[model samples]
Target: MVRWNILPATCILNSCIINIYDEGDCIPPHIDHHNFVRPFCKVSFMSKSNILFGKQIDIVDLGEFRGVVEIPLPVGSVFILKGNMADVAKQCISGVRHRRVSVTFYKMDDSKAPYRFQPDPELEELLPYQL
Candidate 1:
């Protein structure tokens, strides 16, 4: 996928799934862990949602807002966060109005990544070599 180019080569290592189920379900603004590499990606599904990012975010009773930037993640789209967007700013999903699911892919900081390698046989068999 063209979106894969947004990240440095050989950087990705791990991933997780996130499900937002309510209008008020929100993730408080924060930066990613130091162990994770920069320029990670999130693939959105089910419904659209807005992700807010900024140097600082204010969380009100209902949801967080007033970020320097706001990104609308449409269904079946990928959102890439990198460099200033990833490091200098904090991000969160706020004001979700419907059930939404996202698969987030992260790269481990090379300095902190383990040396051992193991592949999931079932997943390997299911995925094409070209992927």
Candidate 2:
């Protein structure tokens, strides 16, 4: 068995696309909270894709939020986003088909660590918190 160590202030974002399709697929624009993310956010592309980033300005071009990166993530290439790397990743998504999929990582606080940690309190405490 493999052992993975996770600690507070520790966050990890891992992405995997087990299935894929032709080109022209894209993940639409989105913003993931930085404070809640792991130290690393990994986005692994299954096939060739054009991941664009920026704010919608007029109709022709997106505002100069940041430069765009043409990420042609290979089959086994792992892309890690740190610091402001993710900020530039928020732009209108196009070019690829919807068959492409990637994952964003988030670090759940210990208070919500789930069954992996100590067995949470009995039903008394758990039931009330769910609501």
Candidate 3:
């Protein structure tokens, strides 16, 4: 079971591991694809870094930065994006200062429902069935 204190009640249908190497590693501003559902979670590891978000983000070539907002993600922290925060704005991780790994978890869009909510035998045994 994947449990987070910040998001007490979340069901993760899928997950992916991301590796960031050194200061030069960066992901340009972009929104997640439609294959992913809203309210996804990213758990950071190794080092802390700042993630910039806005309608538009401009990354300077000299390692400096500019954006509407900067959200610091500390090691072992979970960052969630959903609704307006996920749809209306774009986000990017500026120059990574150190090696880091992130595990992102989210559900699939409802149109892909048949591929979602697969039953986990372990979780099913641990919890009561809902009506």
Please tell me which predicted candidate would have the highest TM-score against the true structure. Answer: 1
Assess the local accuracy of residue 12 in candidate 3 as a C-alpha lDDT between 0 and 100.
Answer: 52
TM-score between candidate 3 and the true structure: 0.73
User: Once superposed on the true structure, which residue ranges of model 1 sit more than 4 Å away at CA?
Assistant: 1-6, 113-128
Q: Which digits, one per residue and each the tens of the lDDT, describe model 2 over residues 1-131?
A: 00133223344322222334445533445655544544444354554444454443122333212225445554445455545555534543454543555554455445545465554366325421222
C-alpha lDDT of residue 64 in model 3:
47
Which runs of model 3 end up more than 4 angstroms from their true locations? 1-10, 62-65, 113-131
* Distance from true location, Cα of 21 in model 3, Å: 2.4
TM-score of each model, paired residue for residue: 0.77, 0.47, 0.73
Q: Write down the lDDT that model 1 would get.
A: 0.75
lDDT ranking, high to low: 1, 3, 2
For model 3, which pairs clash? none
Question: Which lDDT value does model 3 have at 65?
Answer: 57
Best candidate per lDDT, number? 1
Question: Compared with the true structure, what per-residue lDDT tens digits does model 3 show for residues 23-80?
Answer: 5687778888767776787888898988888897886775545779999999998888
